[model samples]
Every structure is written in C-alpha cells, then in structure tokens.
Target: MQQKQTPSALDRLKELLARAGFDWFLGALIGMILLAYLWPAPGVQEGPLSLGELANYGVSLIFFFYGLRLSPEKLQAGLSSWRLHLVVQFSTFLLFPLLALPWHALFKGGSNELLWLGTFYLAALPSTVSSSVVMVSIAGGNIPAAIFNASISSLIGIFVTPLWMGLFLSASTEGFDIWQVMGKLVLQVLLPVVLGIVLHRYWGAFAEKHRQKLRYFDQSIILLIVYTSFCESFARNMFRGYSIPDLLLLGLTMICLFFLVYGIIHLISRMLGFKREDRITALFCGSKKSLVHGTVMSKVLFPDANMVGIMLLPIMIYHALQLLAASVIAQSMARKAGVAAEGE
Candidate 1:
C-alpha cells in the first residue's frame, strides 16, 4: 500500500479558507476590481461591445432562470410556516432599514455620506436566495421555509427596495424619477421573471438540470457589472475621497452589522419558541443581502455609472463577511447537531 502523504501547510490554509467560504468567486470579485483599476477603458467603453449593455441583458436572464427554478408547489407547501415567514421578511425589509436609518444624520453633509447611502442601499436590499438556502441546508434548517422566505424576499424586494431608496435617492441622484425606475425594473427584471414562471412547466426542468451552468452565467454577469461599475468610478475618480482607513472601517462596520442582525434574529427566534431548524432558517435567511439585486438594480437606481461602484462597496463587503461568518456558524451547527444525534 502507498504511504499516505502528509498535508502541507499551504494545503491546510487552502482547506481552512474553503471552510470559511473564501472561494474562487470571491477571489474573482477582487480580481475584477483590480482589472477595473488597471484596464478600465474596456469596461467603460460604449457601443456594440459595451460590457454594461451585456450585463444588463444578463441580469434579465438571471432573473428569468430564477423564476424558472421556482416551484409553485414548494412555495405553496412552505406557506404553512406563516410566522417564520413574517419574521424573516420583516427582519430583512424593515429591521435592517430602521437600523441604518438613524445613522444617516451622522453621515449627512460629510465625506462619508456616500458610504452611508451605500450602507443604506445594502440594508434595503433583499435576502440572497442561493447562499441563504445553502447555508440553511448546511445548518440543518427548514429547507422549505428557507426556500420560501428567500424567494418571497426577492419578489418583495423588487418593489420595497425601490420605495426605500426613493426616500433618499431623489435628493442625491440626478434625474431620479421613481416612475421611470419602476418601469425599467418591470421591463428588465419583473417581466423576465414572469415570463420564466409562465414557461416553467416547459423549461423548469431544463433550468434545474443546468443550474450549475446557469450559476456560472449569473456570476459572470455579476463580475461584468462589478467591473463596469468600478471602471466608471475609477475613470471619474469617485474613489479618490476614500482612503484605506475608510475602507477598513466600512469592512468592520459590515461585520458588526451582520452579527447584530444575526444576534437579534436568534433572540427573536428563541422568544417566539422556534425549534432549532426554524431558528437556523430565520438567522441565515434574515441576515443576507442580495449582491445580485444590488448590482443589477444599481444600473437603474443610480443613473451615474460613477456612483455605482461606491454604491456597491458596502454590499460587497457585507456579502463576503456574511458568507464567511455564516459558513462557520452553519458548520458549527451541523457539527453540534451531529454530535447530539450520536449522543442520542
């Protein structure tokens, strides 16, 4: 028999990072930003080969695929968990915005105002679907409820996110027309989703079968959007005001925001007498913000391409931190549940 080779230090570090959710996708996000910094001209160029235009089309397709995979039966079956659904949705749409609202006064008329707006934008967005469900599954949560809440949250966000942003966007964004934004959202996002759902009986299986491929498609589009947005920002010097300390602070704030929401959801779950699985679902589903929606919607929400990159910073940080923190928490929960099972 061949001797088993000892795992090297680099291998151990890679394993640890993987366990913490530092995957290729996250690395690619960083690479896209760097590429934007170095070679932004390609990303910002308009015309037939415009990456921005391609990303817009990709956003519509991403939502269409999302609707395709959504099973009506699963949604209806998951409806029985009304209380859990209420908690998750309210935590996502209401609590988060409220938490971020009070800080606006502090950052108003200051260098960090844009950062605050970006943070509010992050708060107003919906829970991410794929990662939320994945983390919930990893933690042995209520899968049906997780699916239900994540799906419903996305649909709710299509309306509520705009309404939330409207309160501040009108003052800050030039040519900020709510009706126009709504129309664009309907045309680009809602219509595709509706079309996909209507055709689900025919193509749903195809979507589900090739979901892994579709996911790659989704990531590619997101990367394109990120690159283009950052390219515009860099071209216009939108990031000049921000320093390393400012970025470090924003990242720190993102971590705090995640834990604060996570802790609050956990307390609420216990107070409401939730079982372990239900609590897990609430915690994971309620604490996530959709980077997909953030980037895509920024195309419509902030007309100036320059502001889009800054707008995305908080969500990007929050996205990475949530994934890393949630992965660790989920694995710990899984291990605990397994040990309990063995004990029993």
Candidate 2:
C-alpha cells in the first residue's frame, strides 16, 4: 500500500485560514486599499477606460448575473414561510436602523457625525445574499428560504436604502435630490436586474454554471471600487484627521452591533416559536449586511468620492467581522446537529 503523504505546513496554514474565513478575496480587499494609498492617480483618472468607469459598468453586470441566478421557482416556494420572511426583513431594515438612530444625537454637530452617518448607512442596507445563504446552509437552516429572503432584501434595498438616506443626506450633502438619485438607481441598478430576471429562462443555467467566475468578477469590481474610493480619499487627505484608535474603536463598535443584532434576532426567533432551522436562518440572515451593495450604493449616493471611502469603512469592518464570526458559529451548529443526528 502506498504511504499517506503528510500535509505540507503551507497547506495546513491555508486550511486554517480558510476555516477562519480568511480568504484570498478578503486579502485582496486589503491590498486594494493599500494600493490606493500608494498610487491614487490611476484609480482617480477620468476616462472611459479608467478604473472608476470600468467599475461602474461592472456593477450593473454583477447585479444582472445575480438576477440571472435567482430562480423564480425557488422564490415562489420560499414565500410560504411568510412569518419567517417578515422576521428577517423587519430585523434587517427596521431593527438595525432603530438601534443606530438613538446614537445620532451624540455624534451630531461633531467631528464624528460622518462616522455615525456611515453606521446608519450600514444599518439601513440589506442583508448580504451569498454569505447569508452560505452560512444558513452550513448551520442546517432553511436554505430555500434564505435564498428567497436574501434576494428579496437586495431588491428592497435598491429603493429603501436611498429613501432612508434621503432623510439625512439632504441636510449633509449639497445638491442632494432624492428624485434624481432614484432615477439613477433605476437606470444603473434596477433596470439591469429586471433585464437579467427577464432573461433568466434563457441564460440562467449559463450564469449558474459559471457562478464561480461571476463571483470573481463581482469581487474584481468591488476591488476596483475600493481602490478608486480610497484613492480619492487618499489624494484629498480625507483620512488625515482619523487616527488608528478611531479605526479600532469603529471596529469594536461593528462587533458589538453584530452581536446585538444577532442576539435580538435570536430572542425574536425563540419568541416566535421557530424551529432550529428557522432560528438559524433568522440569526444568520438578519444580522448581516451587504458589502457589495454598500460600495456600489456609495458611488451613487455620495457624489463626493472622497467621502465615499470613509462611508464604506463601517460596512467593510462589519463585513469582515460577520464572515469570521458567522463561520465559527455555523460550524459549531453544524457539528452539534451532526452529533444529535448520530445519537438518534
């Protein structure tokens, strides 16, 4: 018999990182920010082929592919769980914003007002589609329901996020017109998504087959957005006032926000008498926010590229925290489920 080969140290390290939810994409995100810090000009260049313009086009394509993958059958099937859907959606849109709203007074008329706005922006955003579903599945949750809720959340956010921002953005941002913002969103985001859904019957399988490639494409666009956003901020020295301690505190705030939202969802799920799968679904889906939507929306919502980078900071921190925390929790839940099954 052939001897089993021992795993190399590098391979073991990679595995450990994967289990910890530290993937190449996350590393690439950090690299993009660093590159923007070092080289801002290229990312901020104004041209058809400029990174910013390319990223704009990529955003539409990303949503188009997303719509293409959304199976109508699954959506319809998942609709029967209306109570669960209500809990998840309400938790995502209502609970989060309410939690953050109380702090608005503390940061208003202060240097940290912008940071508070970013936090509220993160709160107003929708749950992430891919990561929420992945974590739900891992935790033995309602996979189909997770998919439906995530998809629906994205569509709702296209309109709802801007509405929420309109409440405060008009005061803070000059020339902020809600009608114009809605028009741009319809053309750039909603139209493409609708078109893709219309073509789903024809090309859905192709999109699903090459889903991995599409995911990479999505990440690439996100990286481009990050690079350009940070490039503008760096070029303008927008981050000069903020110190490392501020960033650390912001990170801690994000962690606390996640746990608070997660805990509230758990309690609500239990009160509603949800089964194991549904509670898992609500816990994972309700507490998460979409980095993809956050970056893309920032481009449209905040015309000033310099501020866009700062605005994105909260979601970025939260995104990383949710992935790491959810991964560990999901794995633990999965292990426990397996043990219970074995006992049965």
Candidate 3:
C-alpha cells in the first residue's frame, strides 16, 4: 500500500480559511475598507465612472438577477412550511429590533447614539438571501424554505425598514422623508425585481449558468458603495470620534447579538418540533442581516450622507462575523449529519 502524505502548514491554513469563508471576498472587503481610508478620492461620487451612479445601477441589477434566478414553483412549494417561515420573519424583523432597542435606552445620553442608531439599522435590515441559503444548504437544511424566507424577507424589508427608521429619524434628524425614500426604493429596487421575475421564464437558465460570475459582480457593486460611503465619511471626519477600542467593542457586541438570535431560533425550532432540516433553515434565516439592503437603503435613508459610513459600521462588522460563525456551524452540522447517516 502506498503511504499517504501529510498536508503542509500552508495547506492547513488554506483549508481553515476556506472553511471559515475568509477566502470568499472577506479579505477583499477588509482591503476595500482600508483602501477607503488610504486613497478614497477616486471612489467619491464626483469621480469618473461615478461611484454613485454605478452603485445605483448595480443594486438594481443585483436584485434583478436575484429575481431571475428564483423559481416560483420553489417558492410555492416552500410556502407549506408556514410555521418555519413565520418564526424566521418574526426573529428577523421583530426580535432583532426588540433586542437592539434596549441598547439604545441603555446607551441613552451617551456619545454612542450614532453607533446605537447604526445597531438599530442593522437590526431592522432583512436576512441575506445568498449567504443564508448557502449556509442552510451546507448544513443540509431545507434549502427551498431558506430561499423563500430570504427572498421574502428582502421584499418585506423594502417597506418595513424605512418605516422603522422613520419613527426614529424623523424625531432626531431635520429631513427624513418617507415618501422620497419609498419613491427611490420603488423605482430602483422593486421595479427591477419585478422586471426580472417577469423575464425569468426566458433567462432563468442563463442566469443559473452564470451565477458564479454574477456573484462577483454583486460584490463589486457593494465594494464600490462601501468605498464611496467611507470616503465621504472620512472626508467629513465622521470617524474621528471613533477609536480602535470602540470598534473592538462593537464587534464583540455583534457576536453576542448573533449567538443570542441563533440560540433563540434553535430553541424555538425544537419547541415547534421542526425536523433537522427545517430547524437548520429557521436558525440561519432568522439570525442573518443583509448587508446588501443595508447599503442600498442607507443611501436613501440618511440625508446627511457623510454619516452613512458610521451607519454602516455595525452592518459591515456583523456581515463578516456572521459568515465566519455560520460557516463553522454549518460545517460541524454537516459532519454530524454525515456521521449519523453512515451509522444508519
């Protein structure tokens, strides 16, 4: 028999990074943030390629492609799991806000009000579609349900997130217009999505074939938005008051928030007697927040564009942490499921 060779340290590191999702644009995200800090001038809206215009078009395209890929039959089939869907939506829109609201009360009259608002914004956002579906599928979850819940969550958030923000922003800020925000959302987001769904019958297969490349396209748009937002913020010195310790604390808080939701979903799924797959779907779909929606919505919601970077702080942190944590959990669950199946 031939002896098997041991993997080198480099191979081990690569495996670890892959498992944790670090290899999947996480490094690029961090690099984008740093680039924003260093040489952010070109990313500004005034520059060529016009970061703002490109991001606007990109957001529409991203959602259009999303709708194009979704199958109505899959959505209809997943609708049977009403209980699972309710739990996920409730956790996302209700529980997340409830959890974040207290943080505002706790930190009331503090210098971190902006940060608290950012947290609330994070909480109010919907669960991510692609990552949630990917994580659920990896963990052997009910993927159709994941897809349905994630997609619907985005749709619901288009109306709900602004309503939630309006309540607070109206009282605190000078110009918070609900109708203006809704108009933009309808034109840019809803219209494109509807168009894509209508066209899906013609191009669905083509979309599926090119989804890998499309995913990169989606990320590129996000990076552009991030770089632009942070550049504007840096130019205005919005990050001046923030320090390393503040960021570290925010990161820790995000991790705690993630686990709290994850644990709650797990408990609820068990109490409701969900099968393993449904349980996995609920836990993942409930715990996630969409950075895509957060970024897109911030452009409309916050009139003071400079503060957009501060608003996105919680979102960016939570996005990275959730991907890392969810990937690890999914891998572990997959391994155990495999072991059990083999034993059976």
Candidate that scores best on lDDT: 1
* Candidate 3 local lDDT, 1-344, one digit each (tens): 99899887567445644643456577777787789889877666464468877777888888899889877877898898999999999999999999898777777767788999999999999999877887888789999899899989998998899888887888888888888888988888888888888888999999999987997888888888888888888877888877899999999999999999999889999999999999999998999999888988787788887889899999999998898788778878887999999999
Q: Model 1: residues >4 Å from true position, as ranges? A: 1-21
Q: List the residue pairs that clash in candidate 1.
A: none
lDDT of 2 by residue, 160-252 (tens): 999999999998889889999999899889998998999999999999999889988998899999999999999999888888998999999
Which ten residues in a row are the worst by lDDT in model 3?
12-21
lDDT of each: 0.91, 0.90, 0.86
Q: Cα lDDT of model 1 overall?
A: 0.91
2 versus 3: better TM-score goes to:
2
Q: Provide the TM-score for each candidate, comma-separated.
A: 0.95, 0.95, 0.93
- lDDT, candidate 1, at 43: 85
Please give the RMSD of candidate 2 to the true structure: 2.4
At residue 191, candidate 2 shows an lDDT of: 91
